[model samples]
Structure formats: C-alpha cells, structure tokens
Target: MAADKVPGMARIAVIGAGMGAMATAARLAVAGHRVVVYERAATYGGAVRRFERDGFAFDTGPGLLPLPAVYRDLFVKTGKQPLEECVELVQVDPSSRHLFADGTQMSLPNASRAGVVAALDEALGAGAGERWGDFLVRAREAWDRTRRPLLEEPLWPNWSVLADREPYPSVPHKKLLRTRRATTLAEVAAWELRDPRLTALLENHALAYGLDPRTAPAGAAVLPYMEHAFGTWYVRGGIGELARAMYERCLARRVEFRFDASVARIAEKNGRAAGVELDDGTVEDADFVVAGVAPGVLDGLVPGTALRGADEVPPQRGASSRLTVLLALRGGRPEEAAHRTVVHTPDREDELSRLFGERPGLPAAPTVTVSRPDDPALVPDAEHEAATLTVTVPSGLPVSESAVERVLGVAERALPGLRDRLLWHEVRTPADIAEATGVDGGAVPAPALAAADGRLLHPSNSTRVPGLFAVGGWAHPGGGLPHSGMSGALVAGLIVEGPEFRGSQ
Candidate 1:
C-alpha cells in the first residue's frame, strides 16, 4: 500500500513494475516524490524473469547483461550502495565462441578489441581479423555520433534528422558505373567484411537482436561495436539477479509496488494524465503517470487518446521474438568451457528466408546460441550443470516439439553430445514472452537505432499528453536490459528537470 502523500511532494503512479518503471520510481522517490508501481504480474521484473525447478535456475529472457554502466549510473544516482554491492558481475572471457557450419571456429575475448581482432585473424584467416577490426572502427564512429541522442537524451524534437542520417560510415561499393555507400547492414557485411565467416560474424550481432541484416540500417553497426567495447557479463545466479537487485533498490527508496494489480485505464483529466484505474475499478490519483507497457496495451488504457503526434516515431511492431530451451545436464560444467557458444546455421539463406519470408516458418536448421554459465548457484550441486539455448523466430506463434528439436540439434554442434546428456529440457515460446510483454506476438523490441528511416527508433519518453510519459522498451532508447534501464534515467531526467533537461551527466 502507498503511504499518504506529504504536503510538499507530488504523487507519481508508475504502471508496471518492470525494470524501467522500477528504476524510474526509485529515482523519482529519491527526488522527494511519492511513487507507487502497479504491476499485473505477481513479480517485479518483466521479461527479465527467472525459472527455477529442482534446485536449478535459469533466466527465461536475456541470459547475459551488456553495458553494465547503465545500471552503475542508476545505482550511483539512487543511493549510497552501488550495484556491485547488490549483485556480482562475472565478465565472460572469450566472450563468445562461434562454430560456423563450414567447420571453422573462433573465440572472441571479452571487451578487448585487439584481442578479438587477433583471435579472429588467427582462427578465421590472416586478414579476416583486419576486416572485423576495421568494421569495429567504423562501428565506433556510429556509436560516437549516436550515443547522446539515441541513448542519453530524450528523443529530439527534430528526430527526423536522426531518422534520415545513417551514422555508420558504411564503405562504398560499385554497382555499375557509380559508386554508392552501403545503405543496409547486409551491404556493409558483404562489401567490407568480404569473407562468409566475417559476414556471419558481423550479421550475427544484428540477427541476435531479431534484426534482419539484409534490411537493418548500416547504423546498426553500433550493435557489434557495443559488444566489442563494453564486454558481455553474467550475474552470479542469473541475469534475473540484476532485476532482483534493482527491485530491492526501489524498495530501499520506499517506492511502493502493488503486484497482481492490473491497470485497466490511465485516468485522464483536463487533457492530462491524472493517475490509473485498476481492474477492480479502484482509482488511484497521482500528479503524473508513467506507463511501462506494450504499445497495444498502452493504447487501450486511454481509448481514442492521441498519445503520440503524427511526426513522432510510432511504437515498433512485428519485431522478432525468441524460443528458448532450458537444458539440465547430468555432469559438471567444464572448467575451461566458454560461457557462450553460437552455432551458426549451415544455410544462412534458408534460415533468413524462413524467418522473414512471405510465409514465415521455422528454419530447418536455425542458428542457436548456447549458454552454459559456470555459476554454482544455478545448479543443485557441482555435479550438475544448466544450459540454455535460444533461437530468434517470428513472434506470436505456437512452438512445436520439432522446433525444440531443431534448436537442440543446432546446439549439439557446440556441446558435441548434447542429447546424450539425457537430462530434461523446458521450452519457452513466443506465447510465453507475450504474457510478459503484452504484445500480440510476444515480439521483443530492439534498441532505438540512428537510421533506417527512423523505423528503428521508438516513441519519446514525453508523450503528447501532458503529465503522461512512456517508459521501458516501448519508449525512447528502446529495449534490452541496459537500454530499458537507461530509459528510466531519461524519464526521471525529463520529469525532474522539465523540458530543458538534456540528459544525465
């Protein structure tokens, strides 16, 4: 239950107890505001959820955390205790091992550009590393140009420039007589990377996010640049531990959370957000409201209300979702095993065609990401281990046994004897993700990109309705653990400092 408001403070109603909403509430509370979060689910985290059974734990959504600094900033601004004090972060060495169908393999070192470049050259070929290294250089350029407006600041008033601009300096390629710079990530991969393996390496970054490299803007190069620069990390127990820590942080700040409470409507008064109405018809009034929900759900909250202007970027739709298979292995994890291995599909064309084809269907042999974390907390004992395998697929479809088998088969290349382990496995489909996201297809949102006609950007934090704002993946800066967390910071900055707030320092 929320406490009675103080005379001098404003009451803020935060819809959904997801990462972004919780982060926003904590910050707003520390800023001397009264905040309450209403979540339909019984838990705090949204897609950042955990599944536990028989002493085994697995993160049902994103298995790894990137850009830890985003949460570091939140911890610094919200309280005295830092994020590390809440959860342990283990930097993944050889960040990822890739097993290409062509019988080639390479391991990328964590956060070391030179190490990665060297490793690639040694494993892929002498000059393959140079190509990837060069790509990273250009990717960094995109990151530098987009870091501020795409992440730190609110969606700009003239966001068209961001939409129109392709920040990644894609190399030029000759078509007939004229030379044209690469406009799509596919062109960048083909013209710059050159080698099939290098192209797979580059495109996999975008593919992992459910983005199609063929059409994903060249500005999407920032995706790989981020991993190469910041590094990949795993929480001690699971990625869900990060969510637990953030939830605790919000609670520490006295931000009230009402779980299992469904918000039926976003109460509006005088053309401004007043508060929310629950499913039980109980209305909670507040000075402002922040919605951390899917676009479809948000629109239903206020019928016929124009929450966004025509010129503004619309909420992203039809993004790709994931299919996860949680595996329980009977043996202990190998001490020297890399934490993550990506099994590249043998036929990239067949995979992409099935995923983005006229009639989307499951790939016969899909690329699979296999994660085997070494954390003891995830297994019942040292003798047992847990692994998770994931594949990107079109959202909102029912998964079949064949789909799970295909994903498992692809992962077997990395595990060698994956099925022989004889341990049980659980499957998570788009239907499951839809439950958390509230999207029709359980489609996961991608981070706001600088190009692709602004099709990749999300709606701004400040909405068309006064005192009403959007937060989380559905809003500016877009999705992913770090981006969602950053959205909270952006929303807090806008609300606390008003329109003049550029961004957090």
Candidate 2:
C-alpha cells in the first residue's frame, strides 16, 4: 500500500516485475520517488520467476549465473547489502565437460585467459595454450571496445556514438564481424592447433548461445571472458533464488506488486505513454512507465507508430530451442564432474555442425547439460537431489511422447546408464517455453548480432514515445540475469535523471 501520509508525490509505474522492473523500482525509490510495480504473474519477477514443485525448484528461465558485479552495483547503489549476503557463490572448475565420440573427454577451465591457455596446453597439447592467450587478448579488446556501445546502450540512431576520432578511422565495423564470425570457432581452432578434439570442443560453444560459430559474430569470443574470469556460479538455493532476492528488494522499496495481472495494452495519450491497462479491466496510471517485458510482446501491445521505425526492428530470429528434462533424484550423482557437463561423440564436428547451424532435425545425438541443484535450499536434504538435463535442439521440434522417447534414446547412448538414475522427471519443450513466457513464437531473447546490422540489436533506452522507456532483454545489456538486473537499474537511472522524470507531487 502506498503511504498516503507522504502527500503530494508523483507515482511512477513500472510494468513487469522481472529483473528489469525490480532493478528499476529499487533505484527509483532511492531517488525519492513513489513507485508501484504491476506484475502479470502469480508473483513478481517475469521470466526470472522461480517455482518449487514437490520439493524440486526450477528457475522458469535463465539457468546459469555469471557476471556478479552487475548485481553488486544494483544493491550498493540502492543502499542495500551486497548479493553475497543473500546467496553464497561457488565456482565450478573445469567449468564445463565435453565428451567426444573417440572416447576423449575435455573439460574447459574456469580460470583466466592465461590459466585457460595453460589448461588447454595440459588437456590438448603444448603450444595450443600460447595461441589461446593471443586469441583471448583480442577477445578482451573486442569486449572492452563494444561492451558500452553495443551491449549496454540502445544502438539505433545513436550509432554515431561508435565513431572513431583519428587517422585510423576506428575499427572498421565489418572487421569486427569478420574477426568474430569470419571463421567459425571450430575452423579457427583447427587452423591454430593440430588437435581436432580441441578445435571441435572450442567450436561447440556457438550452439550453446543459439548461434553457429561459422556465421555467428566474433564478438562471441567474449563469452569466455566472463565465464573464465568470474567463474560460473549458482544461486544459494537455485537459479530462481536470484529472482526471489530481487523480488524481496522490490518489496522493501515499497514497490507495489500485482500478480496474475496480464497487460493487454499500453495506454498512450498524445503520442506519449500514459500507463498500462491490465486484462481484467483495471487501469493503472503513472507519469512515467518503463516496460520490462520482451520486445516482441511490446510489438503487439503498443501502437506500431509509438516506436519510431518499429517496423524496422528486425523480425525475430527463430530462437534456439531446448529439450529440458528436470529430474528428482534419490541422492547426488558422482562428485567427480563439475556442476555442468558437455557430453559429445567422436564425430563432434559433424554433430556440432548440425546443432549450431542449420540442421534438418534434432541431432541423432544431442549435446547434454547436466546440472545437479548444488544449492541446498533447492532440495530437501543431502539425501535428495534435483537436477536438470538440457539438450539443445532446433526450434519448433515436436513435443510428443514418441518424439521425447527418441531424444531420450540418444541421451541413454551418451550417459549409458541415465535411465536407471532417474527417480522422477519432467520434460519441457520449445512450445512449453513459448506458452509460458508469451514471447512471440516462444523465441528466447538471444539477440544474434551481425556487424552489418548489429545496430538493430539494441536500440536506445528512449522508446521515441515521449514519457516512455524500455528495459529488460529487449533493451540495453541484452539477456542473462546479471545483464538484465543492471539494465533495470540503468533504465531507472535514465528516467529519474532524464528530462522525463516528474518529481514528487
């Protein structure tokens, strides 16, 4: 309930209580404004929402946690304790495992570039480590140069911001793309080193992010930096705990919470966004509104003209699809492996080619990600364990019992004894994802950026509609938990400091 005692103050409405909305509310409240957030789900946190079923907890979306500083920034700026106080982070070394058909298994390190190179040398061969160092230095530079212009800020008309000031007319934008995607990571490794296993192992990451390395941008190499530098982490209880933490913070800030309130339309007046109208005939109004929802959803809700050149916002790239099987196990599995594993066959190159790029159907065998809920809070006790195994498949795969059995057959071939280990399980398909999130065609917001048209990837925070702002996966700092949280804060900062903010009444 808003404090009526605090008289004469402007009320700010943040639509969607996901990471973006929660982050926005925390910052806006600290800026001395009255803020109320309306969420369309049973609880706060949109795609970031989590749920517990029969003692098994699952994050609705976003299973991996990386980049901790973004969260630290959100809390410190809001005059709250850091995330460490909320959740304990454990680094999973040999960050990921890869099994090849030749019966060779390679695990990548959760160490620095140098450390990663050393590990590669030890795992693959001698000189391979040094080449990795050289590659990483280039990757780091690319990340430094583009992090702000491309990922953080909206990248539309403001493309000029990426301009260079000297005799060398800035890194030719094409060069960046050519460098990242010119040769697939697979091809690059094959050329740099003699080990086919290493090349195929390195190249497979393309499919992980829903891109084909051959066609995916070189900017992708930056992905290793965060994972190797900061180390992959898990929320205390489950990935969902992060969402709950952000939700708690929102409550403390006195942000209004409305669940099961689906937004049907964005209210606009005189070419300006006034507020949002919920599906059940309830109208919530505010001076300024920040939408933390997905862009495709926005495309449907807002007036097409409200977003300048909305038509130009490239149509959705069919998102990467996944066949997720959640398991409730009697006891923990082998402790020898890290929290995550990547199992492959000897013919990994062809297999990965099919997985990462255009493939006819699901791979005869799919790469599997096995994660046991290491966070105790997610499970009842040490005797009971919950884990999820995910296999990336082409989007729009059929989700029938027979189709599921076919995939499971492949999983059995890889794990050899996977079926006997399962106590109980649940399977989620791309269709399930689409129905749950309401993103157009259920495409997960893995923005595939190409140098030629990377500008279309992130548009500026200003939605062109006066008094309106956009946040979350569709806005700056693309997808991922940390990025979204930081984006929420950034959006709020823009509104509070920008000319649009209407101070307390």
- TM-scores of all predicted structures: 0.98, 0.86
Q: What is the C-alpha lDDT profile of model 2 across 1-505, one tens digit per residue?
A: 2211122355677778777778888888877778888766677656664657777776656677887777877777776678777666666676776666566656677765767777778776788777667666666676676665555544435453332211111122234346422333444455554476665555556566665666555556666655766778767666667777777776777777777778888888776677788898777777777787777677667856647465334434555666777777676545564667666644565655665556535665666666654566767666766766776666666666765665566555434566776677788877776666666545555542435234325555567677677777667656667667757766775675564332211
Candidate 2 has its poorest 10 consecutive residues by lDDT at: 164-173
- Model 2 stretches astray by more than 4 angstroms: 1-9, 154-156, 160-187, 304-306, 310-316, 345-360, 406-416, 447-452, 499-505
Which ranges in model 1 have alpha carbons more than 4 Å from their true place? 1-8
Local distance difference test, each candidate:
0.89, 0.64
Error of 2 at 286 (Å): 1.0
lDDT of 1 at 484: 95
Residue pairs clashing in model 1 are none
What digit string (tens of lDDT, one per residue) describes model 1 on residues 163-205? 9999999887888999989989989988999999988888899
Best candidate (score: lDDT) = 1
